[model samples]
Target chain A: METINYQNFRIEAENICVDYNGKVALYDANLRLKPGQICGLVGMNGAGKTTFFNALTGFVNISKGKIRINGESLRSAQKDQTIAYVPQNEGIDSQFPISVWDVVMMGRYGSMNIFRCPRESDVQAVKDAIERVDLTDHLSTPIGNLSGGQRKRTFLARAIAQRASILLLDEPFSGVDIRTEKLISELFIQFKKEGKTILLSTHDMIHVREFCDLVLLINKTVVAYGETSEVFTPENITTTFGGISPDFLFGPES
Target chain B: MELFSFLNLDTFITDPLTHDFMRKALLMSSLVAAVCGFLSSYLTLKGWALMGDAVSHSVMPGVVVAYALGLPFSLGAFIFGVGSVALIGFIKQKSRVKEDTVIGLVFTGFFALGIVLVSKIKSNIDLHSILFGSPLGISLSDVKQTIFISLLVVILLSIFRKDLMLYCFDPRHAKTVGINVFFLHYLLLTCLSLAAVVGLQSVGIILVVAMLITPGATAYLLTDKFDNMTVISVLSAIISSLIGIYVSFWLDLETGGSIVLAQTFIFLFAFLFAPRYGIFKLQKLFAGYK
Candidate 1:
C-alpha cells in the first residue's frame, strides 16, 4: 500500500513537453507508475494533466521527452500490446445502435493484428466484461440508450476487457453520476489490486486523494508530486482553480 | 396508370440501357448514389460534412493541375482534397481561427486557384464535366474506377466501421483508447477523397459533393441511431437516383443535375415534414399551431 518497486513500473514519462501549435501545454512533466498502482493526475483547466495523458497514449505527437510502458517506451509497449487507454468519450447515447457485446469487442482490436478479426475468445472476454459490469441484462440493448452510470460502466467494462497492465483514463469521472463514480473508483482500485497500473487524469481532488496511491499536480509543469495526501492541500486546490470554488470536485450538492 | 403505357416504362426500366451511355450513366450513378449515402451520414454526424463541401470544391486546383500536367485528373483532386482535410485539421489544432473561417479560407483559396488554372488552360480543357458532371460521360474505364474506388471506400470503412464512428462521435474518447486519432482522421479524409474522386468520374464534383451531404442530412431527420442514419440515407439516395433519372428522361433534361435537384427536394421535404424531428413539425408543436 505504501510503495511500489520503481524498477517494475508500467508507465514512466520523463521530461515530457507537449505543445498545441506553439503554445506549450506541458513542460518538463515527469511521472512514473508501477503495475499494481493507481496514479491520479489532478490539475485545473489547461493544467497539462490531459496533455500528459495525450503524450502517453500517442494522441499528440511527442514534442519532447519519453514515455515508457511496462519498462518499454511507447514504441515497444505499443508493439507488445501491454497498454490500453480508456477515453472519456467512451459513453454512448441511449439509442446507440451497437450492443454491449459489440462495444466491448472494440477492446480486442488493439490486441488483434490487422489481418485477423476478433476471435471467439475475444468475444467471450467482452461478454465476461459486460457481466462484470453488471450490464448482462442490457447486453443486447443499444449503448446510446443506457443511463449515464451504465455508460460509464460500459467503458469500464471495455478497459477491463482490454486486460492490459496499463490503463490511461481522461476525465472519466466527469458527467458520470455519483453512484457510477463510486463504482468506477472501486473498479480502479480493483484493477490496481489485480496488478494493473492506472494513470487517470481528473479534476476531482477528494476522490483522487481518497482512492489514488500517488498524485501528480499538473499545470503546464509539475506543481507537486508524491503521495495523494501530501500532494492535495487547501492551498494547492485554491491555486489550481485560480479562486473558483472546487464545487465540481466536491460534488454538485456542495 | 395508363400513363405507364404512353411512357414506355418497360422499355426504360427493363431495357433501359440499349445505349452504352445510358447504361454506364445508370450503373455509375446508382453506385455513386449508394456510396454517397453512406459517407454523407457519417460525415454529417461528425460535423465533417461542412468540410466535405470545402474539400470537394477546394479540389478544383488539384483537378486543374492534374489536367495541366496530363496526369489522371482525379488523382490530383483526391490528393489535394485529403490534403486539405489534414491541413484544416492541423490548422484547427494550431491556430485560434474559428473552424468555419478556416474552411472558408481553404475552400475559396483552392477553388480560386483551380479557376485560374482552368482559365489559363480553357483552350484545351473540358471544365464543364468536372464542374457539372455528365453521368452519360461515364466510360467503361470510368465505371471500373468508380466501382473499384467505391468498393475500396466501403470496405475500408466497414472494416473499421466502429473505429470510424467512434472517431466521428467523440474523438476526445477515441484517443484515450490507444486509437491513433490523427491517423483515423486522415483515413476518413482519404476515404472521402476517394469517394469524391470516384463520384466525380461517375457524376461530377457538384453532384458528388451534394450526394455525399444531402442524403445524410435528410436521414438525420429520420433517426438518431448511427446505423439507422446510414441505412436511411442510402435508401433515400437510391430512391432519388431512380426517380431523378426517370424525371430527367421524361423532361428531356440533364441527368446528373436532375438527380441532385431531386435529392435536394428530398432534403427539403425531410427537413420540413419528418415526424417528431422536422423543423416545421417542431415549430407547430412549440406554438401549438396546426
Candidate 2:
C-alpha cells in the first residue's frame, strides 16, 4: 500500500525469437522499457504483437534469447508476481457465471500463497479496483451482463488489482466506445505517474501519438523503437502494414 | 386419481423401505447424482459438455477390455476415458480437424470397438446393464465402491474448487498467476473420469453423461454464484435421485432412466421458473404488459 519506487523497474528483452511448430513467427527482437512510461506496441494483425506479449509473460517459449524484468529473468518475474497481463478478450466465455468482484479478486490469486485465504488488504484492493473502474454498482453482477466497454474496464481493474510494477495489455481498446477509450487513456496516465511501466498493443495510430511516451513498430521483428514521435511515421506504418492501403496511416490523428 | 394412487404411503414408501435391495439402489443413485451434479457445473461452464459425453462413451472399450483382462471395470474405464481425452487433444493439436469433429470421431470409434469387443468376449458383464444401469442388481460391494469414489470426488473437489474455478473461468489468466494450467486440466479430467466410472453403474455409460451435465446446468439457471451453484446442484441431484428411485419402484421402470428423467424434469422446472433466467417469468412479465 506504500508509494511504489518506480525507478528500478525495467523490462529488457534481448534477441528474443519465437517459433511455433518449426514456423518462425517472431524473429530476433530487442526491447527495453523504463518505469513510468506508456509504450504502445504497434503492428498489423499477425504482426506478432500478441506473441511478443505472450513471450514477456512467459506464456510461450522464447527459443533464442532472454527477457529480464527488474533485473530478474522473465520466469523469475512471473514467479514473483511482478508482471500482470490482460490477454486478448476474444476467448473468454461471456456466459460464464463469474461476477465482476470475483474477476477482480482473481488478480490477488497470483500473488497470494496458494492455500492461504485473502487478507483484509487484498479484499480492500479488489474493492478499490472495481470502484476505480466505476463498476461498483455491478459488483455482484455476472460479467456477461456487463456492456462491452464495462467488460473491458473490468479487466483493466483486474490488472490494477494485481499491483504489479509492470503491466502487459493486449488490445485493451478494441470494441470499446469513446468514453471507455478516454477512461483508459486517463488511467494509463495515472498508472505512469505512479511509476508502473505499461506496454499495450493497439491498431489506433492516433491513440499511440496522443498517449504513448514510446512506440515500438514491429512486423515479426523490431522495425523501430524510440520516442513515439520518432518511431511512428508514415514510412514506418507503410512498412509494418504494407502498401495495400495507406489511408489508415495518413488519416488525421484523432 | 389413479395416477396419484402410486404415491400412497403404505404401498410405495413403506414397501420399498422394507426391501434392502431397494434401499441400496436408492442410496447408490443418490450418490451418483450428488457427484455427477457437482461436476456438471464445471463441465457446462467449460463448454466441455460434449467432451463429457465423449469421455463417457470412449470408456466403453476400456470397460470391455478390462472385463476380458479380469481387472476392475472402473480402472479400465478411467484409463480409456483419460486416454480418449489425450487423443482428442493430440488430434485437435496435430490435425486440421476442429475439436468437435475430432471428439465425434474418437468417441464413436472407441464406442464401436467397445461394442465389438463386448460381443466377441464371453463374459458376465451384461451389455444391457452396461448401456443402461441396473439399479436393482447392484451388489453391496458396488455400493461400497460408489460411496468411496463419491467421497473421494467430493474431497478433491472441495480442496481444488477455487483453483479449478479460476482455471475453467480464465485459463490464460490462471497461467499468468502461476497456477499450473496443466495440472488443473488433468486434475479436472481425472475427476470427470472417476465420476463417469462411478455413475456408469447407476446410470450406465449413455445416461452417465446426462448425470454429469444436468444437475449443474439446472443449478446454473437458478444462481449466478458458483458456490451456490454447487450447493444447489448437489441438492437437486439428491432430490431427483430419491424421487427417481421411488418412481422406478412404483412403475417397475429402469432405475437409471427414471433418475435421469427426474433430473431432466427438474431442469425443465428451473428453466421455466427460475427468477432471473427463467423463460416463464419473462413470458409472464410480457403478458402482464400486454
Best by lDDT: 2
Q: Model 2: per-residue lDDT, tens digit, B201-229?
A: 88899988988889989999998898899
Model 1 lDDT tens row, A1-254: 33545458677788989887788888898888777878888887777776777688676777888887766767666555566766665333444446666667766666665533778888888988888878899876767667767877787788778776788887788888778777787787678677888888876666687778888777788878888877677667656666655554575543
DockQ, candidate 1, vs. native dimer? 0.25
State which docking tier applies to candidate 1: acceptable
Give lDDT tens digits, candidate 2, residues A161-204. Answer: 98888889888888888898888888988998888899999877
TM-score for all models, in order of appearance:
0.84, 0.93
Task: Give me the runs in candidate 1 sitting further than 4 Å from their true place.
Answer: A1-7, A89-97, A243-254, B1-20, B65-70, B86-96, B169-183, B201-203, B219-231, B267-290
The model with the greatest TM-score is 2
Query: Which predicted model would earn the best DockQ?
Result: 2
lDDT of each: 0.75, 0.86
Q: What CAPRI grade goes to candidate 2?
A: medium
Candidate 2 chain B has its poorest 10 consecutive residues by lDDT at B3-12
lDDT tens digits, residues B49-139, model 1? Answer: 7778888887888988887897876689888897787777778878899989998898888888888888988756678888877777665
- Model 2 misplacement above 4 A: A1-9, A248-254, B1-5, B282-290
